[model samples]
Target chain A: MKTTAALSRLFAGIQADLDLVDKTFQERATSGLDILNTASMHAISSPGKRLRTALTLLSGKLNTYRFQKLLLLSVAFEMTHLATLIHDDIIDEASTRRGHPTVNALWGDKISILLGDYYFAKTAGLIADIEDPRIDHLFSDTVATVCEGTILEIMTSGNADLSQETYFEKIKNKTACLFAACSKGGAIISGASPEEIERLHAYGQHLGIAFQIIDDILDYTQDQSTIGKPAGNDLRQGMVTLPLIYALEDESQNGYRQQVQSLLTQTTHKEEDITAIVGWVTRGNGVKKSLLDAHAHGNKAREALYHFPPSPDRDVLDELIDFVLSRNK
Target chain B: MKTTAALSRLFAGIQADLDLVDKTFQERATSGLDILNTASMHAISSPGKRLRTALTLLSGKLNTYRFQKLLLLSVAFEMTHLATLIHDDIIDEASTRRGHPTVNALWGDKISILLGDYYFAKTAGLIADIEDPRIDHLFSDTVATVCEGTILEIMTSGNADLSQETYFEKIKNKTACLFAACSKGGAIISGASPEEIERLHAYGQHLGIAFQIIDDILDYTQDQSTIGKPAGNDLRQGMVTLPLIYALEDESQNGYRQQVQSLLTQTTHKEEDITAIVGWVTRGNGVKKSLLDAHAHGNKAREALYHFPPSPDRDVLDELIDFVLSRNK
Candidate 1:
């Protein structure tokens, strides 16, 4: 309810454009085969934040809003995002996202793999039609970074000794890069100056960092009903995210640190242990410190929007930072 | 030895360029991360037919033969092929290919998925550098078709009643499209005339169909040591390939057809039954009939090349049809 209200408020200016992005995505994503159509429809019909699309549109609105180009770009970005999620669920062995069954859960891993690849192929087709070399490079390069970031995260999975800098690096590649591409690509299409494009890119990168940090925090702080998946999934999957990193680094939480250390180093995780660590991180100033970092990034995102003159789109872009920080799911 | 000799004879003209493609594929496919680099190295070090690379280069040779552009295109095509194989191995639950362990066999499906995506990302980066909308569209569109083809195959996977037309459709999309892209993309880069481009594209399409049919044929006739994987894997996996389809449709082999039908349509496949079917396919008219179809497609590919005047590269391309048809593994 809170997220819906916030999205309605945030996307009020661009709802029609967002709807077009959604529609174009659905039509383009379908393969016209029964199983693929049904599976893709299920994945596409799910409610997503559409933050990337909003950023692209709002960024374009700041200048000459090229609806057609921006629409294609937004659809490409969101489709790419969906493709990654489908593949990530396979990697995460996740059954659900946002209270809905994942493509992997419903169709099995083989179909999920092909479906993800199909989306990626569709995304490439869309990117090809855009015809802008710069945008093309941005989209493809960002996807590569995202893949590398995922590899980095998997490599560091269960490593309790992961540094703060490494966590930042992982999130930057995995999440922030796509956000950067969205804003940067939008700006490019809208004829924004190089300096403005840089600013929007920065805005998106910081916003994405804040977004992922809050997501990590919510894993420790929110429940399945609220966050739409079980809490502490990161820990359950042996993922060492922001809150756990903070908790591990905090000398003040030495007792909880040992508990998390064992949990992280153990060959296998137990349900009760994951629950207990989620409790410890929630109470041991980990979430509090992570929130501070999230706020810092949020502030950085806000600063990126300062160059643009005061406008409705600008205001929405500004409010998006708060939404990123505050959203439960 | 025969295969190596054939490759040497066929690639004598373009061995330097082909060598450069190998060197470049190695450098670009690397992520500089240890695990990915190691896994990618393992995949790269294994000997692949590199027929796609040869097709791209030889196609270019027919015209301007832009060395650098063709090199990039070849690498991208091969990498795309590699990425698909990585993912396909996961879907097929394949333990090995060509006497080497698969990425999935070594690192598990999660790593294989990321590695495949990483290769795909790398391919995109290379494609972006090419700066041609036509090439970009071709690469992406071919990949999409390939994914669709794979999905089509999976959907038809246990259906004993699948039609020959549908089988043709699946292989065309899955295999021939990529081949067509390579040849046609090479022609486009070389500034081949539209008519020449279409001819080369048709040549590739027919050639790929012949190649895949032979592959399907080998699955029944070749032993594990000879083929690098066990024979009858298609039957084991419930995949109805050309030979199986042929055997089923052959009215003269009614007794064998019933046995094969029971094996295919049954809830579970047994080892002995699979062995029995492989023997039946070898003895029945299925292999002979499938071979005739392969030859028919091979002749069409040869006819498509009739437009090109005789040259060493043309001859090599011509011999490639024979090589593809006659190779034991």
Candidate 2:
């Protein structure tokens, strides 16, 4: 896996462009109303990885798309991400995001909810000028998919009935779809040809799958402080992600299946049990197998990019797949 | 003011057209998922005045725009209204809407919140096909404005310092904006000329302001059984609407402002106090002044339409103004 220093150097070429994204994001979040304006600023000011905007900027650079249009598209994608993050925090009952107090934590859920909607409105407003039918539906449909995916996850929470296939489906909806939209939407707006667009779509899909798997793996592998969230948060919330799903498969073949099943199917969890399960999942080959699976998706993402000529932008995208896969400790 | 029966007769010509709207609304509400599809259906099925749809259809008839496009635009307005309604119910903690269980009441706030987002996504999906930049920004900005307005209301909720001007400003952002959008959007999609569009915009603005004034007036004047919501709801929630703003003026002149000011400033309310405040506001002709103010706006709406030739659609638009005024009783 690439080191942090390597990843930073890979993106250094786009640092100037990313700074533009930061400025645009902050500028667009201004609402003119004091409270809303402040909340909007605060929501965007959080240090997001800017992954979606990076994907968008990188994709646009693949072709000779208008720089101005690409900037707008990048802003739209970032705002869309921020919008959902607010709602996601509310659902997770999370008090902090990126080590900062969440909008929900600081202002409460009512403001968080509306602030999220405001961000979405800002996203749509940014894209409204794009005037592409494909770009138009791509965003709203992605939102619907993300919301549906989260709802499905909530409904399936604590169910021992969760399958590996369902786990992939859930992550695809909840996380990967937006990434796919970010890649495909940038290409579409950038005037990428049909085949190129399709290839980029696949690249985004595979990259997103790998990204989410690594996220799930991080839940078990990373310690509390570095991850900025409690380890095994998914388990405490009764959510079964990839690591536990693989762990359960291993446990089921042995004698510990029912023990894990009882813990999962229970409506609530004791903290110690959560800790034990996190440990058990890590001790098993669950984390190992998950990383391997993520690597497989990463390879697919690389393969999808083979048709595009190797430019700096394409190289960064290629490195990003590795960067996402290597994010875990 | 026109009687309810007279208003119904005025709309008879568009009865067939409205039936088509009902059909389209139902057809569009269907998602493949059981929960969302059912929730969508439930959200729309509760009988509404369908006033926004009516405005769109009637506005379309004044111009030569395609009926099909008008249908899409009208449905967009209704869905936008429905989307905000779901979120509004969450903020209000409302249990029932129009005598039917609210989405928040039937589903938890989590579902309600996502369901609201789903509806918004649906609304955007519908309008993404419109290809008009004006309509696109209109829906999104109206959404932002509505959310901002609600946040402002919440921030100022127990503050006795709210002014009459501020109350109007709040309602304009929260309620009048959507109504104005319905009018202007319909005209824009229907290909109305710039001048005519401005006229229709004014008509909608005045109509919406009048509509909201009457709505606030009804909260004090109507019975719980008739309104399907508790009377004095705004007061119980510590919101100072136009009626109270006007009543405060009357009370101040009579040296009773401090008593009412203390009640308004309270965060929580006893049932009897809510009842007493409701009576106090009514006794001072707050409801009467509010209705008169609504009528003045209604007259302005009528005056805005003076240039349009007499047709069934135009006549209905005019009488609809009176119907909204008479709805208080």
* Alpha carbon deviation, residue A280, candidate 1 (Å): 1.5
**Fraction of the true interface contacts (Cα pairs closer than 8 Å across chains) found in each model:** 0.66, 0.68
**Model 1 chain B lowest lDDT segment of ten:** B257-266
For candidate 2 chain A, the 10 contiguous residues with the lowest summed lDDT are A1-10
State residue A90's C-alpha deviation in candidate 2, in Å: 1.1
Measured by C-alpha RMSD in angstroms, how accurate is candidate 2? 2.4
First chain TM-score in every candidate? 0.97, 0.94
Q: Tell me the tens digit of each residue's lDDT in model 2 across A252-282.
A: 4466566667887776778888788889889
**Residue-wise C-alpha lDDT for candidate 2, range B98-201, written one tens digit per residue:** 67899989988888888877777777877887778888998888888888888888888876668888888888888888888888887787788998888888
- Clash numbers, per candidate: 0, 0
- In model 2, the runs with Cα more than 4 Å from the true position are A1-7, A252-269, B1-8, B252-268
- In the range A171-210, model 1's lDDT, one tens digit per residue, is 9999999998899998999999999999999999999999
Indicate the docking level reached by candidate 2: medium
Q: State the number of backbone clashes in model 2.
A: 0
